[model samples]
Target: MNETMRPVLGVSVAIWRGGRVLLVRRGREPFKDHWSLPGGRVEWGESLQDAVRREAAEETGLSLHTPHLVDTLDMIGAGEPPASHFVIVVFTADATGEPVAGDDAAEIGWFEPEAIAALPTTPDLARIVALSQRS
Candidate 1:
């Protein structure tokens, strides 16, 4: 099997404040330039919560706490043989400090749930936003 076919664990954090969620414009492939949550592939030996915190901080420059697991998404690339497959664990957390783009993020901003529909985003981002709202 090709290494790219192997499923990897990833984490995404929906850092919320004042009825809005933080979103980033991805600066890398697999969703380049698309609006998405702050997250990345989990490193070996890292706990889920730790990965979430690390990713959130790395991508958005904000501190997060008390992450509540919101959903798990199977992010499968669409192509003849598929480009990537990631099992993404999504969480909602309380965030501190203003967000600034860093790492794989091109831009970062807070967005209301209704505003999500106006942006180009990763697959299932709307659903993820809804799930975050319920949590």
Candidate 2:
């Protein structure tokens, strides 16, 4: 029997305040060295909401509030090896504590709307942020 491959389903939390968005420098594979939103994979049997909260806490060392589903992205492979196809669900959230990069994040920073254009963000992520700013 041939085994079918499955796309990794993950969630991301886009924490925004005023005109700035929180971004993280990835520490691992799949986009290492690029600026991206903070989040992680959903565990088996875990609710989406719970997964978002858990990933936020684990990666950023902060507690988020009132997250709302914002957008969904289908990421196709762009680079080499183990080429991933991901279905990423994005959530907008509010958090209190200052962000400190942990786990898979190498660094954390907040980017203003204008600065967002200059960041090395993924194409899908750029679209999400654009729509979010308008909404």
Candidate 3:
């Protein structure tokens, strides 16, 4: 397939503790400096659950389990000409231990659903957070 025709696969994890969800500030683009779920691209030969586990550990320093599929996000780039396309698999998982930001995260925090609206985030983050909370 052509480069533009190939859809990149990625995973994002929604980790909840108490009544708040974990979020990481992206240290890279396409949504640099924005608060978003902890995840990254799915490497070749990796299962979706494995990708979610790996990404969550890399970004948030937490071990996650039982990643249940929550949603799928289509991120179509916008520019003079469309630049990229990503099909992100979103998951909700249970986690333990305090989080420390690493990898592609600039910072990390837990926020209530109501508070998420006030922060800048990737598209549909608030909705994803809400959906994950219900799962």
Tell me the tens digit of each residue's lDDT in model 3 across 76-124.
8886456878899999999987899999999999898999889999999
Between candidates 2 and 3, the TM-score winner = 3
The ten-residue window of minimal lDDT in model 1 covers 1-10
* TM-score against native, each model: 0.94, 0.89, 0.94
The candidate scoring highest on lDDT is: 3
Any runs in candidate 3 off by more than 4 Å, and if so which?
1-4
The local lDDT score (0 to 100) that residue 77 gets in candidate 3 is: 87
Candidate 2 contains a number of clashing pairs equal to: 0
lDDT of 3: 0.92
* Every candidate's lDDT: 0.91, 0.82, 0.92
**In model 2, how large is the Cα lDDT of residue 32?**
85
When sorted by lDDT, best at the front, the candidate numbers are 3, 1, 2
